[model samples]
Target: MGTLPVAKKKKAGRQKCSSKPVKLPDDASAEELARLARAVAHPARVRILRLLTDRETCICGEIVAELPLAQSTVSQHLKILKESGMIQGEI
Candidate 1:
C-alpha cells in the first residue's frame, strides 16, 4: 500500500487583507461627504436638519420644541452637525 502524504500545519494568525493603503479622494467635497453622512447618522440629527431647512431662521429652543427629544439632547445633535460642517450657528 502507498503511504499517505502528511498535511502541513496551518499558521494561527490573522491574515492581512491588503498591504497597500486604500486611496481616497483629495477633494474637499469628497471628504465632506463622509463627515456629513456621519453628522446625520442619527435620526434626531436628520430631523433637526429637515426642520432647519423648512425655516428661514431657527434657534436651539425652537428645535427642541419641535422634536420629542430633550433640549440637551437636541443641542448635542446640533453640536455634532455644526462640528461636521453640516450646519451654521448664528450669534
Candidate 2:
C-alpha cells in the first residue's frame, strides 16, 4: 500500500512585523490630540469625516441622505464636529 503524503506544518508563533514609529509635530499638544480623538470617537462621526474628506463641499441634506441616521441625528453629529473644529459651516 502507498503511504499518504504528510502535509507541511505552519510555524506556531507570532509573526514579526517591522514598522516605523509615527512622528508628530512639536507644536501638537496632548490636549489637541485628545480633542481630535473626541471629535471622531463615534462611528457616525468617523463616517461623516470620511464623506466630507471625499468632497470639497457638501450640504447637510446630502450628508443626511448618505447616512442611515435621521436628519436630526446627522445634524447633532455635524454640530459636534463643528464645535470640535473638525468641520466648518456657514450660517
Model 1 over residues 7-69: C-alpha lDDT tens digits? Answer: 112233211111112223466586668776798799998887667656544556666789999
Candidate 1 stretches greater than 4 Å from native:
1-26
Candidate 2 residues lying further than 4 Å off, grouped into runs, are 1-26
Q: What is the C-alpha lDDT of each candidate?
A: 0.56, 0.59
- TM-score (C-alpha) between model 2 and the true structure: 0.66
Relative to the unseen true structure, what is the C-alpha lDDT of residue 88 in candidate 1, on a scale of 0 to 100? 44
TM-score of each: 0.63, 0.66
Which tens-of-lDDT digit does each residue in 5-67 have in candidate 2? 111112332111112223335798989788778978999988977676665445666667899
Scored against the true structure, residue 56 in model 2 reaches a CA lDDT of 46
For model 1 the local lDDT of residue 37 reads 74
Q: Whose lDDT is greatest here? A: 2
Compare the candidates by TM-score and give the number of the best one. Answer: 2
lDDT of 1: 0.56
